[model samples]
Target: MDLADDALRDRARRAGIAPDWTDVTGQARSVAPETLERLLALIGADEPAASVPPLVTGMVRQAIPLPSEAGTGAAVLVLESGERAEITVHPGDDGRCWVPPIDRPGYHRLQLHDREITLAVAPPRCFSLDEVARGGRMWGLAAQIYGLRRPGDGGIGDSRGIAELARAAGRAGADALALSPTHALFTAEPERFGPYSPSSRLFLNPLQADPAALFGQGRVAAAIRTAGVAEAMRRCEAAVLIDWPEAAQAKLALFRALFDGFDAAAEAGGGLAEDFAGFVRAGGALLQDHARFEALQAARLAADPADRDWRRWPAALRDPAGATVAAFAAAQDREIRFHLFLQWLADRAFAAAQAEARSAGLRIGLIADLAVGMDATGSHAWSRPSDVLGGASIGSPPDAFNADGQNWTLAAISPRAMVETGFAPFLDTLRATLRHAGGIRIDHVMGLARLWLVPDGMAPTEGAYLTYPAEDLLRLVALESHRHRA
Candidate 1:
């Protein structure tokens, strides 16, 4: 190979793009040079400079090594509890300066010179199943969220059904109820109903939100009747196979009617309205991004049915923070608020379900299943495109289950972006899953270490495995799991 070719391979290797991989058939194959180049460009791989990283992670009570340059700087350790300590970075036996062990397992800030870095101190391991069940063995059941049924679910399973199941399962002595992915999906394209291919892992499927839980059942029934979905909902419940597009439409119409009532209530001022305001406040920018994306996608689809994908929208609208998007949001303020209401209802319903399970004497309550990746055209990619691989899809090589191979058409998180952003995207996704659950079952858990990435529009056989910062990710997961006691 030429020197330039050699350098390219070196850069690819440093970026964690595997030069070769073994297939499911136990055959070794090498990634093509062009394939490597494409993957590398998608990630925009740039090695971090010689400095303290955006974030540092280590176990509690374990001394952490600091960069040699950090030795000369004044280090101030700010604990999460508002306490502060001035510490010295002394060299260890290996001749590297190490910060003193932190006693707490929490995210603390370390100020060194002009740079402030986050210290993510994790527990040694995750909360074990033994701690959850407190017995020799534990048993639980798993269900698809959409397949769950309850009276007047609007032709699809809703969080109210989950609450009902949780109560029944707890009464039956089940310790946990595992759920399928509840991640948000495309509101404009209801036919795309795969739960695993979500719009954003940081948000819930608003379609599954059951307003009946918040609004009294009587009020919800009135809304459903007024929305004229009562007949369709009954048919959906009786159908052998779900009519996703129809059911989703019915559910959304019902939600809109409920949202109208909610807005009216909010204007009058009450505790529930304040609670919703608090939810919106806590949601911060992330929540606004998701809600805005939902509203914008719907608006785009209205103008042209084929314009649902944000990437194909006007360039100005493609950027979440662009002027066009801001103007669109301003013009459609009520539409955006309607989407926000959906999320608010979903959040409250899920939280209530978990609470009911726990109150019914189930120890673990719920184990939320987290999807492996997000849809390429979804909210996460639209709001923070750099945080994910743009021109790649997550998939697997030829395996026993599928001889032709499989292309999930899902976006993988960009490893470089994770480091540059201090793993904020990863942490947000994890925290979202753990928000109202006792535990989380990470789909394709192997993706934590590495993922098989297929170039967009390329055959899965042409894909290569991309390595991740597994150690750091696992540490974060353990820390979160311990915090949630899951």
Candidate 2:
């Protein structure tokens, strides 16, 4: 390698970029210098020789590196239970603090002088099968949530279908049901239908909602006829492969009709009106941003078909919290509310499915699948731009199977931003996936350690590894797992 190449590689290495990696077959390979340059550029590293600062910085960012061995320090430790005490750490001691043993496990706070940091005190391990089953072996069924079909499912498999399937599985002695990622997908572009690439892991796919759950079967049938898509719906349901676009259109039409009816009933003080209001209130800003994005994308597409990607959207409208978005939401209130209503229905259906599974005697009723990352053009990235990296994609290094490597085209969370936010985005994602589910299966769990990040429009092999706060993330996961009994 020449001087410039060496410089670029050195800079990349300093930034936690892996220049060489061992593949699945244990074969080592070195990445090209050009790849490293491209990746560094995408991450806004224009100066190759520039120094990279510590990921966590600022006054509120000090961390007490919690090693197995203890250290001496005078600090005030605040337990999660609101109990506080002054303590002095001793060198070479076991993992015990100076205060009384913390029985309740959760994230607490530590104040040393003028600095304060988060202290995650977790149990030795998460709840295990050995404790739950008492040495008994348990078997369960894994299912694709969208592929579960039932009569009158409006061409797309839904949570109602899963609930019915759960009943059957329970009767056949199944104690658990693992499901595919039910993460939210693009409502505006149904062609981008992939369970692994979701718009937001925090929300459920509105398309997977069973209209019958909210609107009665009779009402759904009437709406289908009113929308004049009965034939299309029938064709979608009977097709061997899922005709996503056709099915999505038909289901969306039906949802629109359902929304109209719901709105009328809500105005007339219907029984579910208050519940819907409460759900909206609970969803808060996150739900509002998603709904607003969907509405804006729809409007933009209607005007110009090329306006699908939010990144290319007009400057003012791009920011979710900007005045432009606020004005748009104000003018398109009904449209935004419609999207919110869809989420409410989806949430109800999924919760009902989990309830059905548990009621049918399943111990681990619903196991949720959490995707590794979100699509770059999707709602989560659009809403939390600060939390996600721009102009970069999460991918894998070249392996024996594909010497070219793999590009997932998904945006990864920025470690620097994660630290600044105290891992709020990560915690929210975990909590959302755990909601209404007995357990969660993390896709690409290895990503917690390090991720291969490729520059936008570059080949997968043209990328480098970026380390994450794995220890902190694992501690949070363990705490959440114990709390959820997952």
Candidate 3:
């Protein structure tokens, strides 16, 4: 190779960008220089010639490297349990430090010289299955939550339907009911419907909520008639496949009417008013952001049917915490409250399903599916833009299945950002999925180690593999798993 090629390859190697890779056919292939440059740009590795070693940020069972300033001195180690200890940092070659065994498993802090670093001490393995199985074979029933059919469902299967299914499964000696992702989808753009491609993994899909569960059958029926969607509902229910647009439209109209009645009842001091108030209070900022996004998207769509993506909206309204967004929330207060109310009902319904399964003697009641990532233009990315990588798409490399490879068009979380944010986004997602379920099935679980990322407008085969902080992510998962007993 020429000098220029050698320099480029060396730079790629330093940035963790593989210059060449072995294909599935056992043939060695070199990555094109153009591909490398584009991929490097997406990751913000502009100074490719800079030789920098990976920084050690956390510690588990293995020892981590330390800076030169961290001399051979006793460092103050603070455990997650508020216990502090002075541990001697033994210096080694290449500016590395040996961290002694931390008996506890938690996020701890280490003080060395003038620097303080967060050290995560994780257990060797996750919660063992034997603990819950007790040497017995457990059986589970996995079903598509949306495909479930039931009377008075108004076309779309919902949490109430899942609850009935759970009861039936429990009676049949099933220990678990695994359901597809219930992640929140785009409320404004119902045409872009796919359970796997959700707007946010941190919230539930309001469409899966049973209006009748909270509003009562009579009230739901009255709302259906009031909204002039009874005929549309009948057509949707009788259809074989889910006509998402039609069903979503009908449901939204009914929900608006139901919300009107609910608001009036709550105004008269109904008991549910206080319950909903507490739910909103508990949801806090995260819930408020989601509700605002929904309302804003709807308002934008109404103004111009072509404007659906938030990225295309006015600049000031794009930021979730900006002054414009806050003002919009205030102006569209009623609309935002309607979205929040739907989420409240959905949460209540899913919680009821899990309760039903457990009360029926099932050890593992509900197993919820957690999609790998969310659409880049969706709420999760908009709300936590820093945590997500821009100008890249999650995809798969060329293989026997598809010679050209496949791009899922999903935005993945940035590994570096996750570390910087102390994995708050990941932790929040895990906690939410575990809230109303006994276990969570992580979609594309292999993404924990590495993700195949393709630069925008590029062929999937030209994509590069991006490494993730696998050990750290797994440790967090295990921690949450133990906390939820999943």
Candidate 4:
């Protein structure tokens, strides 16, 4: 390579793009110059003026060096618990000063003279299995949530089935019950059924909700009879292979019946209705956005099947913050509430399963599985486009098993956006996965360090390894693991 090419590769390397890598076959691969340039532009790797990043992360009692400009400023450390610690920036002989050591592990703040940056203090490591099992090795069972069987599940698995499995496993001396991803999938097109390619990792798949978990079995029985799907449910249970579309339709119909008279029950007050209200209140805008997207997608699909992807929708409706979306949400108020009700039921159902597991003598109870990516046309992409790579697909490079490489067609979290947005998106996703679980299993955990990203219309083999803020993300995971004890 010439000097110019070497210089270009150096720039790419400094920007966290791997200009060269070693494949599984022990062969060295150099990224094409044109490809590196394109990826650099796509990732916005142009160097910015020296400044504090949105987040700084380190282990508890580990002193972290700040940006050059921030090293000499007067700083105050603010703990997450509303307490303030007066600390000074201690400059070293090398000129860079270190933030005072934080003894606590949490999302604290460092108030400097010019800027305030979030200090994510993480424990030394994640919660250890030894702590949960009390120094003994413990075993657990893994399950696919959809394939589980129980009476009255409308032909597919539901949270009630999972609860039963947990109880059984706990009795058998299992310490954990790991399960497949419960991430939300498309309710508009039930045929697109895959756990990994989800609509939103922030929410649960409502189809797996067990109404009887929250409402009584009597209410569920009445709703099933009222929806007139009793015979259909029986046939679904009798099927050899799961008919995902039919099962989803049946489950939606049952949920619809329960939602029909929900207003009356909510008005009656002091029961599931009050609990649902509390849920909606706690859910806030994020929940509202998901519900609105669900309702809007279903409506558009009903009008014209071609209107599947939100990107193709009208310019006004394409923007979640636009007036058109507000108008649509206002018009479809009840429809939006129906989606919210589904989420509430799903959340309650999963909570019940975890409760049953822990009560049945399991040390860890349930360990949730977090998918690496979401569908590009899904709710998360529609609502928060900036949080993900806009036109790229996350995939794997060529290896012994796949010579041509593999494109997963899943959207990836944008590394640049994570730093620019203070890692809010990643933190939200991590917390959501750990919400009701004793632990979490991250699919493709290697993605935290780097990912193979194929730009739209590009061959998978043409993709390059895009580096991520591995240390910062790991520290965030450790912080959340301690927070949730997961």
RMSD of each: 1.8, 4.6, 3.3, 1.7
Sort order, lDDT high to low: 4, 1, 3, 2
Output the lDDT of residue 324, model 2: 92
In model 2, state the lDDT of residue 239.
84
Q: Write the per-residue lDDT of candidate 3 for residues 1-486, one digit (tens) a residue.
A: 789988988877766678887777988878778877876776666633212122233435666555555566788988778888998888787765666767666667887777677665656666665678899988989999878877667788988888888888888888889999999999888888788888999999888888776767899899988999988888999999889999999988998898998887887776789999999999998899999998988888899999877888888988999999999899989989999998998898888888888997678899999998889989888887877887888998888888889899999887766765667788888899999988889999999988888888888888887778787788778767776888
Give the true-structure RMSD of model 3: 3.3
Give each model's whole-structure lDDT.
Answer: 0.87, 0.80, 0.82, 0.88
- Between prediction 1 and prediction 2, the one with superior lDDT is 1
Q: RMSD of candidate 1 to the true fold? A: 1.8
For residues 1-486, could you state the per-residue lDDT of candidate 4 as single tens digits?
A: 999899999988988889888888899999888878878887777857336787888889878887676756567888999899878887776777788788898889898886888888999899879878787889999999878977799778988898899889988999899999988898888988899999999999999888888888998889998898888888888898889888888889889898886766787887778899999999888889999999999999999988899989889988888899999999999999999999999999999989998998889999999999999999999889889886888999999999999889999988888887889889989988998899999999999999988877888888889999999899899889988988
Q: Is candidate 1 or candidate 2 better by TM-score?
A: 1
Q: Score residue 88 of candidate 2 by CA lDDT.
A: 60
- The best-first sequence of candidates by TM-score reads 4, 1, 3, 2
lDDT tens digits, residue span 186-225, model 1: 8889999899999999999877877767888898899998
Which run of 10 residues does model 1 get worst, by summed lDDT?
Answer: 44-53
TM-score of model 3 vs. true structure: 0.89
